[model samples]
Target chain A: MKLIVSVKRVIDYNIKVRVKADNTGVDLANVKMALNPFCEIAVEEAIRLKEAGVASEVVVVSIGPTAVQEQLRTALALGADRAIHVETDELPEPLNVAKLLAKVIEAEQPGLVILGKQSIDSDNNQVGQMLAALAGRPQGTFASEVKVEGGKVLVTREVDGGLRTLSLDLPAIVTTDLRLNEPRYAKLPDIMKAKRKPLDVKTPADLGVELKQHITQLKVETPAQREAGIKVDSVDALIDKLKNEAKVI
Target chain B: MNILLDSIEKVVGSQNVLRGEDVRSRTADWMTKEPCLAGAIVRPANTEQLSEVMALCYEANQAVVTHGGLTGLVRGGMASSDELVISLERMTQIESIDCVSGTMTVQAGAPLQSVQEAADQAEMQFNLDLGARGSCTIGGNIATNAGGIRVIRYGMMRDLVLGVEAVLADGTVVNSMNTMLKNNAGYDLKQLFIGSEGTLGIVTRAVLKLHPQLTATNTALVACEDFNSLTGLLQHARKSLGGELCAFEVMWSSYYSLLTTESNRHTPPISSDAPYYVLIESLGAEQKESHERFEKAIESAFEKGLLIDAVLASSDHQREKLWAIREDVEGLAHLLAPRFAFDISLPILEMDKYVRKLQSAVSQRWKNAKVIVFGHLGDGNLHVSVATGDASDETREAVESLVYEPLKLMGGSVSAEHGIGLKKRKYLNLSRTPAEIALMQTLKIALDPRGLLNRNKVLPDILA
Candidate 1:
């Protein structure tokens, strides 16, 4: 069976993101970008299934500008069999992307479609559910554990209180959570060979789908910095400040 | 009484002074797991504030122990309840990076990791690196004259430091902040404080020299069948690698195997076999040509019977794993408890015989004792550790005597990189002559007449 994974490019976690002076968006000039953490987990899960011999092939897809191919190549380096880049100037809304993915699913008909719970960038948390609705398949979101048997996938999802388990038949959609698996480092030898892997590029027109946007972002800004706190000399002083200065107690 | 505390508070605002439970909350040093024994710790913001604080303490006849990251291998940063700590924790600031001069002026307390990162951003590096870079401070490195993995290419901390700003015991600030490569103007005052271990003065700030960041770094771990092969391989690397040879670290089979196999330790990239393993690294400008030369060097070493097996790290991830095996010795702390670590400098020719004799002597003393040896073979520095399964005071004393007893005859110094703290005070005479000791004492009396700045360290206490 074939496993299709969705990979997205996001800012590297170690870097401190800078907000633009005009508040247009994050200033990404010359900043290091890497595969989204959740997406990496999704790729890792797909690779595990392939390693277990349950999946014959793993194909990773990314939808964005030309630069996003870097993330696709990284996924290939990490053990994905092949890559497909749906070329577009900007990422579409979750619903439009779900429609585009649905078109790809109709053509390829993969047994499992794994995606990140949400891209760290934008963080819509809607693509997996929308894709499941468009494809008419059972869905598992925020999956922490996944087990596969004959014709079914048991997904343990992360919920508010604890984990909840659900069983979905094959040809299902599942989004990965942090605990799905620890991603492996792309080995040097594999990275060198990943450049040779097949990477097919196409536009939304090639997939017989039209991309459209519904929501418009007016501006983006960084969160306000918290004020530094002062240490109190004693418990009495702390309580006094809380009652009079902080005015909360 | 609170009078002295109030005086110190006046010097460096009341909030900067940490006492009572706060002092107890901090660990003594990187090695000691126990709470610190300090009357109070004053964190001055910059050089002026530190000078004022020192003045107040000096007038009160108080003993002040300067504190950095507390990552000293020797007990140099150790303090007792009678001593007050002048911690540079609050003075952490990378004031500026002068690209033209290739220098960085930093307050004494900035962590080495951030300094390295900042230098990297400026397309340069301080080239003073060690395993403790994450936790240690630039001040501590300067105070100890730290010699790390790259000493072969970039010399020790003393060579990297261009100038230093130190506060004397009498609270006088001596700022020799020179940012030039060639400044032969009079006596360089920075040399006195570089490796004085805080006895001469408390280092408050420093102007550190930086080097152009090397674009190409090639690393490999090779197995050596014998000591002669290790020497031959070193010669081969020196010839083939040219001036790009940066690090050549040798780990004896005992330590290499122990750390690689220890629980929570980084697994070795190459199989742990043979009597020794040498980690070779070369950094240069041309990546392709340097890599070719490095590979050729290793291949020639193997062809000439200088090395048995070799594995090159082709990626940063692979290189980091090989380095982790050397840097994360703390992972084996549980198995090697009650260990004695010695950083000794001796002739490279004397190492093989010295190690064999030391191991034999330690085994005869403790039947189950294990000797783990590793260090920078290029710098004539050996870090020898002995674990006797006992951390008792008697065991520590016995191991110290065993390690230092033969050093005098070999014309070796008791310490190579780590300065003599309270731990090695008694062994000072073994390394320094009586006249040299007298001169050191005379200078100590002349500069710090009160004998308060890091007293009873690096030199033997007066024998009444």
Candidate 2:
């Protein structure tokens, strides 16, 4: 069985990000970029399946600017067999990216397709479900556990109450949760080899999908300033302030 | 074999199958646990069937291991051959992103980056971050109480989580997805799983608090002549930068030089020869004002003789290069063979003396052993690496004792950001008191009566 994993490039969450002055968006001129955390988990899960010999080949794909190919390279380094980069300078919206990814999925025709639940930069959780809908496949979202039995996929989902389990047919979309698998670091050797791996670069024109930006940024501004409160002399005074002023008691 | 396979098939259906060698990969975590290893791996799709699966496992006395994004430094998720591996790879979904409430409710398997992004999309920020944010699950972060660079400004994973839902050892679902920031109703059951490292129960979902996104950030690389100067700079930055002071990371000369060596990508910001270097950052609403204040703070420190030399990041590229010096620990990792990485915390006042004493002790014992130190100094946390000339059982024990023994007297902790996995299990007592240790064991037993979840971790062995 073949597995296709979708990943995205995002700002490293550890570094505090600031929106640009023009109110356009976050300043990404020289920001430290990385693979979206959930997407990395998705990639790790796919690679693990391949390593276990359950999956024949792991193919990674991403829809973004040419720069996103770096994230795909990272996935390849982590043990993906090849990658597909849907090159677009502008990330139009969740639905557009999903549409592009669905096209890639149809072409690859992998047994399983995995995606991060959301992207760190956009936090749009619609892509995976949208891809599932576009692909006309059942989705196992927020999966905590996944097992392949006979010809069906059993997925354990982390839900409001607890873990919920379900079964889906083959050729399904599974969005990875954090607990899926610990992603392994790409060793130096693997990083070198990933450069030589097959990377198929496609464009919106090639996919025959029209890119559309659904959301427009009216203004991007920082949160209101948090004033420095008076330092209490003692615990009793602190409690009084918390109760009276902050009312966080 | 058919009976076991048949039982699993009853819950997940015929297609979800794993047997024999396929089970080995899921059996053990990084630390390698024995008894709770997976005899099979059952992947259930939703909560109801997972409950049924857990019920079956509990009835059969078969230990079940819940797996999420496995980037945990600790072995809390490791399974054994007699157990079953229940992976959450399919349950990754963002249930909701509440903009008004400033919260995001997500499945336990959702990656930390995914939650952070969801918060970002809502024009809010999830303050919980770490090096493993790309691969680690929010559940694992909660389980480990993960702390990253932002711990100084936003606190740890414990501070970010409003509520959680987890499955007990017996597969009983405990849902406590509280969205309110101030919910003091009862025991705060979410606390039980927040830092327990997945031993008590398997966390499946969480409601995490979010903050408004910052608009501006100012970063700098400064050189300190001594520990006193470092402390002085920290105080001045805290007072002058006001609430905007977000990060104050320190790097020893040894660490800085190692990064700036010929083969490395980073060039020394100042000289790579200072006794100590600090990477300071401030995030605020006004970039112009924050930059002005940052400049003034450094100017004041320089006048007061607290700083010898300082370089403000003029451009984003320069700023990144400066940070690369601090974040690149791989240089030190390469230089040292058989290195033991230690993350510890001590009171700010006691840190200098403690480091000196530990260095002297290590030198006396090993002669050629090198100790490199650096960390988030603002939060009193330090990451120490001891590269030994020889790797032996006795050498390891001696090095550990020398490094950890001083921490006890200085009222410091053995494991700071990193949880006490198998590596630091024996040294737990160096930090926690006997009464605290006893209470921890009691909680472990009370919650996991069968000792099935992440056994023999985070706590020391009981004395006879």
Candidate 3:
């Protein structure tokens, strides 16, 4: 069985991003970028499956500009057999990205596909479900744990209230949540070998998918700074201020 | 104390002062959870206000303790019950970043991480970095002359600092903020304040020298068979890496095994069974060339029997993983609770024999003692941690004597990068000659004649 894991490059979680002056989006110039943390969990799940002998090969796929190949290389170094880079000037919206991934799924015919529940940048959480709908496959999203047995993948999802288990047939879609697995660091030797691993590049045109935008970002502004609170001398002063100044007592 | 607080409030606004329970609620330092017992915590927003507060303290002969991030293991920043804590918490501001000159002027209270971030924003690198970077302040780094992982290449905090502005204990402001690379005009007075542990003066601001950001970083964790091979590997790495080498951290087998076997946390990337592991990192301009050279050096080292096995990090994540193993000092403390940790410096050639003697001495004292050793082998600094499942004052004294007593004969320093704070003040003479100690005392008495600044720290009381 073959497994396909999807990854995305995003700003490092540790960094404090600044808003651009024009407010179109975050100013990413001269910022550190890493593999999307949730996507790392997804890639780790796929590698674990391969290591468990439930899967033979793991192919990591990324849909973005040339710079996103860095994330693909990271995935490869973390144990992916190869990488498929869907080259595009700008990444399309979730529905269209699902259409393009559906094309790759049809072409590759993998037994299972794993993706992050949501990228930290967008937080859309739509691509995996849309891809499953386009490919006519069952999806076990937000999977905290995943196990493959008897041509089926058992996914334990982290629901709002508690755990929810579901068994999906082969050729299913799974979106990994944070508790899925901890990703391993790419070893130095593996990183050197990842450079030699095959990375096939394709375009949306080659997949016969036309890009369509369903949403337009109007402006991106940082949240308003919190007002500093004043310290009251005593309980009496606090009550007096709340009653007289705040007028909410 | 109340009258002194009132005078301090006149210099710095009353709102800036934290008193009574507020001062007592805060922890003394990062190493301990004990509630601080200072009379008050005075936070001045700027250097001028700090000088004013210092002037008041001098007039009253009131003892003052300067506080940075307080992450130091030594009790340098610890204040007594009556002493007032003059904290730089409010002075945290990066005043300017000179891109052309490659220098930054920052207030002392700014965290090292914030300074590093600002340097990153300017596309420059601040070479002084350590595990406490996020918590440690620029003032603390300057005061202690912090020697971190990159000290092998960038030298200590002393080398990274261009100029410093400090307030003398008597409230005199000394402004020698020179940013030039070479200014041999007169005495470099900044050296007097740095590494002085706030006994001479309180650092308020500094002009820090920055380096051009190195784009390429190559890191590896390699295994060596024995101490000789480890030293040989260091020589080989330095030769092959040349000026690119920034860090050469070595971990003994015990330290490596302890850090890795946590299993649920900090998974080891390679086998921890190796006798020694060296985390080598190099920074350069050309990524491909540096990576190739790093790999070639490792290959040659293996061929020369300097390394038994090695793993190189191909990406930033991998590099961070290799560093995490070395930087997990807190985990080391947890694995050996109530441990007596020593940071000592000796010649590289004497390290193996010193460890053997120390090991034998420790085992003779306690048959079941567990000792873990690791440090920046490049700078000849080793951090030795000993644990014997006993936490008593007498046991601690015995352990400290055992560690520092042997170093005197070995011509090694009892305190390496960590200064002679309250912790190692008793053993100052072990590492210093009588003449050297006298000169240090003369300088201390001349600068802080009242002995009110950081009292009972750095210099022993007997010297006074």
Q: Give the top-scoring candidate (TM-score).
A: 3
Chain A TM-score, each candidate: 0.94, 0.92, 0.97
Q: Candidate 1's residue-wise lDDT over A199-218, tens digit each?
A: 99989999999877888878
Sorting all predicted structures by TM-score, with the top scorer first, yields: 3, 1, 2
Supply the DockQ value of model 1. Answer: 0.07
Q: What stretches of model 2 exceed 4 Å from their correct place?
A: A1-249, B1-6, B13-38, B262-265, B461-464
| Cα error, candidate 3, residue A208 (Å) | 5.6
Report the error of model 3 at residue B40, Å: 5.3
Query: By lDDT, is 1 or 2 better?
Result: 1
Interface RMSD of 2: 12.8
lDDT of 3 by residue, B1-464 (tens): 78888988888989888988898889996666778888889999999999998998999999999999998888888898879888999899999999889999999999999999899888899999899999899999999999989999999999999999999987899998999999999899999999999999999999999999876777888888999999998899889987898999999998998889743356787887888999999888775577678877887887798987777664476678779889998888877887988899988889988888888998999999988999999899999999978979888898888788878887899888988899998899999998998999899989999998899898878532
Candidate 2 chain B minimal-lDDT segment of 10 residues: B27-36
DockQ of each: 0.07, 0.01, 0.21
How far out, in Å, is residue B246 in model 3?
A: 3.6
In the range B140-164, model 1's lDDT, one tens digit per residue, is 8998898899998899999999989
The C-alpha TM-scores of every prediction are 0.76, 0.63, 0.85
Interface RMSD of 3: 4.3
What is the lDDT ranking, best to worst?
3, 1, 2
Task: Tell me the number of clashing residue pairs for each predicted model.
Answer: 0, 57, 1
lDDT of 1 at B331: 64
For model 3 chain B, where is the 10-residue window of minimal lDDT? B261-270
